[model samples]
Target: MPNQNDSDSNIHALLIGIDNYSSTSLFKSLEGAVRDINLVEAFLKNTLKLPTERIRRLIAPNREDTVLLVARSAHEPEPTYENIVKAFTELTEAAQPGEQIYIHYSGHGGRATTIYSDLKGEGQSDEGIVPMDIGQPDGRYLRDVELATLLKRMTDKGLVVTVILDSCHSGGTTRGDYAIRSSGETDTAIRPRESLVGSREELINNWRSLTEGIHRTAWIPVSRDYVVLAACRPTESAYEYSVNGKERHGALTYWMLDTLNTLPGTLTYKALHDRVGAKIQSKFPSQLPMLLGEGDRAIFGTNRISTHYTVTVLQVNASQQRVKLNAGLANGLDSGTRFAIFPFNTADFANKQKQVAIVEVTDIEASSATARVLAEVEGGIGVKGQIEPGAPALLLAAPTDLVRRVRFHDQKQLGEAENELPTQALVDQQKEALDAVRQALAGNGWVMEVQPGEEGHYQVALGKNGEYEICIGMPIKNLNPPLMFRDAAAPREVVQRLVHLTKYQSVQELDNPASELMDALEFILLDQNKQPFPNPSNITLKHGTKAYLRVKNTASQALNVAVLDLEPTWQISQIPLRGNNAAFYELAPQETADIPLRFTAPEGAAYQQAKEMLKLFATRGAADFRWLRLPPLDHVIEKQHEATRGIQSAFGKLLEAVGTEPNAAPVMTRAAVYEPDPNADWVTKQIQVTIVPESLLPD
Candidate 1:
C-alpha cells in the first residue's frame, strides 16, 4: 500500500458539511452533517497524519449548541454555492501533478428540473447538493453536471481525486425516527438558473472540450480520474441515525470510518466499498451505498489489499472464551457456523500457519453474532499470540442441515360465522389437511414450521378461500402480491414451493466477501433491438419483448457461469446454456457470451407491472446451481430428470444434502462430511428488471 506518511504534504482535502440551513421550514436542520465532517477530518489528520495546513473545511454549525462546535477562524465561510466552487478552484490551482485530492460532502441533496435545453429531452431530473444558504435569494444548488465539470478540471491536471457524498438525492421524508438527507422537495423552483456557477453554454462547452467530442450529448461524462462514493441509490433515502447509542451521524460515514479503523491493512476502493456496504445494510437495508468510476484503483492510488471473505471480531470475552462478530442473521449467519480465526494482520489467510483458533457460532442478533472458541493454537512463548478483537474469521463450514423457518397462520377459523359454525366433517377435513402439511415438512432439512409470532423467512396463511397464501415474512412497501395455491394442491407440493422460495431468498443474499473479482465480471442487459440499457436497475420491458444478457468475462481466468431468472410469479429457472451439454457454460478469459431472454408478466390483472431479478453466478469451477431451479408456485412438480449417478463434487453434495427428502434425518452431527476448498471462490451479480403489460406502453 502507498504509505500515507510518504505523501502527507502532497494530499489536499476539501470537506464541506452543512447542518444549519437558512430555510428551516423548507429544509430541515441536520444533526449529523457537522459531526460527519468532524469524524472525517479527524481520520485524515490523526490517522493519515496529514498536516493541518493542507486540510480545508467549509462548515455551517448549529449556533444553539456550543458543545459540538469545531474550532475554526471567524473568517471561515459557510458551505455556500460560491464558496464551494471557489474551494474547488483553489484546490485545482494549488495541487501539483500526481497529487491526491479528497472531497467529502455531507448535507441535503435534492432533485430538480434541468435548466439546460439539451438535457430536457432525457426525461430525468437533475440531482444536486443543497447549499447552506439555499433559502437566500441568490442561493443555488451545486448540480451534478457542474460538479462533474469541476472534478474534470482537477483530473485534467493529472491529479487523483476521491469524492464521498453522505447525502441522497431522493426520498426526503423521515422513516420512523431516522432523518433523511434530502431537501424534501422536487419542485422546479429548486432549480436556480440565475445562480448557476457558469452559463449553460459555457458548462456544456467545457464538458465537450474535456471529452474531446465523445459522448457529445451526455450530461455527465464517465471519467476514470475520480471515484464517487454515494450514500444510496437515486430512489432510496440516505439516513442520519443514532450511532453507538448517542451522537447522530450519516450511516455511510459511520460505517466507512468503522471499517477504516478496523481494517487490518490497506484495501482497494472496491473492497472498502463492499465492507462498508455490508455494515450499512445490516442497519439500513434500504440504503445501498454505490461505488462509481475507477473502483479498480487503490485508495488514493495506494497499494491495494486483496479481498477476503472474512468477518471481523468486534469484541473478545476472556471469561467465556467467546468473541462477538460483526455479522449475524442479516448476513446469513446461523448457529453451528464454523470459522477459522486468523491474526489481525495476517495478509494471506490461506496459509495454515497463520491460523489462530477455530470457533462456532452460539448466539446471533440481527447484525451481530457470538462464537465460542473450540480450539486454539499453543503459542504462549512462541510466534503468534491468542485470538483478539479485530481478527478476521474466515468461514470454514456451515450446518449441513440448514432449515428455513416459516410462520404458519390459520385464518380460516376467522371466516366462519359465530352462529354458522362448520360441520364436524368439515372440521375433520381441515385437520387432515393440517396434519398432511405437518407430515410433509416433518423431517425436511430445507424448511420448518414456526408459530405465528416467531421469526421466519415467509408467512404461510390458510385463507378463507381454502388456498394457502404466502408472502414475505417482513413485507415492506411495493412488494409483489401474495402467492396463492389452491386447496387441492398436494402437501408435499406446497413444501416444495416453500423450499424454492427460501432458496430464492438465499440466492439473493449470497455473496463472497473474499472473492477478488468484485467488478471484473460484467452482466449487461440489452433491449429488444440489442442495444445496451443505459441503467440496468431502472430497465422496463413490455410483455413479448425479447431481451438479451451479454456476460463479459473480464477476470483473468476461465469461469463457469450460470444465470437464473427469479420471476415475479415466484419461479426460479436457469437460462439454458446454448450448444453446451454441461450443467454450466464456461466462458474463457476476455470472452463474452450473449444469451437471449424473454420476460412476460404473470397471468393476472393485478400484476400489471412486476419486478424480477436475473442472478448471475460465476465460479472458478463447475457448480451445479440446478438445485436452485424450480417451477412457479402454482405449477405442479413433475419428475423430469434424476440426479447424476456416481460421485458428486463438494458443492454438488452440499446442495444434495440441502434437498434431501423428509425421510432423512432431521439433524446431522458436526462430523465433517466434506471440507470445503479454502481457495475455491465464486461471485454473484443480480440485475432487476421491471415487467409491464404491453398495453401500458405508449404508442
Candidate 2:
C-alpha cells in the first residue's frame, strides 16, 4: 500500500517466495528456488525507491526478505489451504503509506477445477487453494481466475501494487499443451488462440464479488495508470535454463530483472519491453518480456512539471487567413530537447504504409513555434516554375517504385532504398496535404489555386500577402454565411458553427452548448413575416464594436447562457430567461425572451492586445458548427406552401404590401388582417439597436 505522495525514502517492500511439490503437483523449478527469489529481493531493495530497513522477507529462515508459507505434502491428510490465504491477508492488512507489496510466485502451475462445498456430499469439503498431494487421490492445483479475484480485492485501496506472475500457466483461456506436426503429419490439438481464454461467467462472477461490498464501484475504465507484466502470452509456458552451469533463473524473469537493473535512468514501458525482449532472445532466442503500465509521461514543449500543451494555430495575416501553427512547450517539458516532426497520412498509415512527407527545419521562427523547415526547389525544365518560399519547401514525394536517394538541403540523403521505391506512398502524401489545404480554404478570406500539369498532377499555390482572389473554376463550398440580411442569421451561423466542432474528434464536449444556443437565438430574430431582415440578417461585428443578443427559449428546459472572453470593452450582466412571451427576461415554457448586452469596443491601439482572448471565446462559442455547410435554408413562402397556419398568417401582410416599394420593410400594423386569431394578442418588441445597426445590407 505505497501512497503516491510518499517521498522516495519512505516506501516499503514485501517479497514472497514459495517452493513445494518439486516434481509434479507442487510449485516447482527456479521460480520458487532460493537463488531466483534472492536475486529478485535484492533488485527490489536496491533499484526501487523503497526503505531498505522496512523490507519484509518470508522465505528463508531469519531472513527479512522472505515470506515462507507452511508447506503441505501431497500425501498429507486434509492438506491445508489457509496458510497461503492467511499470509496474503496479513500482508494486505499491514499495508500503509509508502509501502509496496510485491507477491512473486515461481512454482509448478497447472489447470485446477473449482469445487464448491455444496457440490460435494453432506459434510464433504470446503473451498481452498489445493496442493498436489501424491498421497491423496482427490487433490487439485490452482486456477488463475480464483487467484485473480482474491488478489484484485486485496489490493483495491489505490495501492501502488505490482503482481509478478512467473509461472507457466496460460494467462488467458488457452491450453498450453498441443501436438506439433512431425514431418508432414497433421497437428492433433487446437492451438491456444482457438481455445477459450476464460469463461465470461467466471470473469464476471469474480469481479462482481470483488466489487460487491465496495461503494460506488463499477467496471474498471481503461486507463494508462494500471500496469501488468506477464512472462509470456497466457497460452505459452515460461522457459527455464537447459545449459549446464548457465544461470538457473527462468529466461523471461532473469532478463526482466537484468534489463531494469543495468539500464540507466528511467526506461519507458515500450522501451523497456524492446530492450528486455531483445536481450532475452539473444541469450535464449525464444523468450519475451511483457511490461505493461503507464509509460514515462514527460510533458512535451514545456518546463514546468505538468502534462498538457497548448496547440495554437496563429494567423500570419488575419484578412488573408494565412495561418501557421505555434505549438508551445507544455509544462514539465525537457527544455531544449530535440523534437522531430514526423507527418504521416494517418489514414494511409493504418494500411501499414509509411506515407511520410518529411519537413526538415532549416530555421526556427524566433517569434513563433516553427519546428520543421521545408526546403525550396527551383530551376527545372518541364517542372512548374513557381518561386516558392526558400528552406521551408515540402519534402516532395516522387512517384516511383524504387526510391534511389532523397537528397535534402546539403545533398544529404534523407532516405535511400536498396531496390524498390515507395511510389504508392508518395501519391497518398500528396492527397493528404491537398485535403488539409481544401479544409483551410473553406474559411473566410482564403482562396486556393491548383494549376494542373500538362502531363499529370498539379502545381499548388496559396494566396499570399493581402490578396483576396476567388476562382470560379474551383469547387464551390459554403465559404460565406447564408441569410446575411436578418438578425436571425446570427442564430443560423451559431448552428452552422456547431457542425464545425465535429470536424475534430478532440472537441466533442462542445456539441451540447452549440445545440442549446442555436435554438435560443432562432426565436428572437424573426418577425411577423417569419423571415429574417433582408438587409442585414447576419452582422459581422468589427474588432471594437459591442452588441446585444436576445434568445427566446421555445423549449421546456430552463436555458442557461454564458458569455466568455468579453474583457474591459465587452462585458455581460446577469441575463435570465423566464417569461410567457417577453423579449429580455427568462422565457417560460412555450415562451420567447431577449438578452440585452452592452459593452464598449477596445480603442484602435488596444485592439491587438485582446485579440487572442476574444478569438478563443468566439471560437468556443461558435463550437465547430461552421457555415461552410448547412442543413438547408428555406424561404418563408415555402412554409406557407406547406399549409402551416402560422406561416400563412405571418406572411399575408407582406403580400398586401407587394404593390408598394419592394425595398421597404413590410409593416404589419393591421392587427386583424395579419393576426392568426383576432383575440390572440402576442406583440414582438425590438431590443435596443445602439451599437449594431437597425438592418445590415449585403455586400
**Candidate with best TM-score:** 1
Position 357, candidate 1: lDDT: 75
Per-residue accuracy of model 1 over 303-370 as CA lDDT, tens digit each? 43444435766556656378767555434567887777787545687686787777788986534568
TM-score of model 1 (CA atoms): 0.52
Q: Model 2 Cα displacement at 266 (Å)?
A: 1.8
In model 1, residue pairs whose N, Cα or C atoms come closer than 3 Å (at least 3 residues apart or on different chains), thus clashing, are 2-303, 308-514, 309-514
Q: After superposition, how far is residue 164 of candidate 1 from its true place, in Å?
A: 1.1
RMSD of 2: 26.6
**Decoy 2 TM-score against native:** 0.36
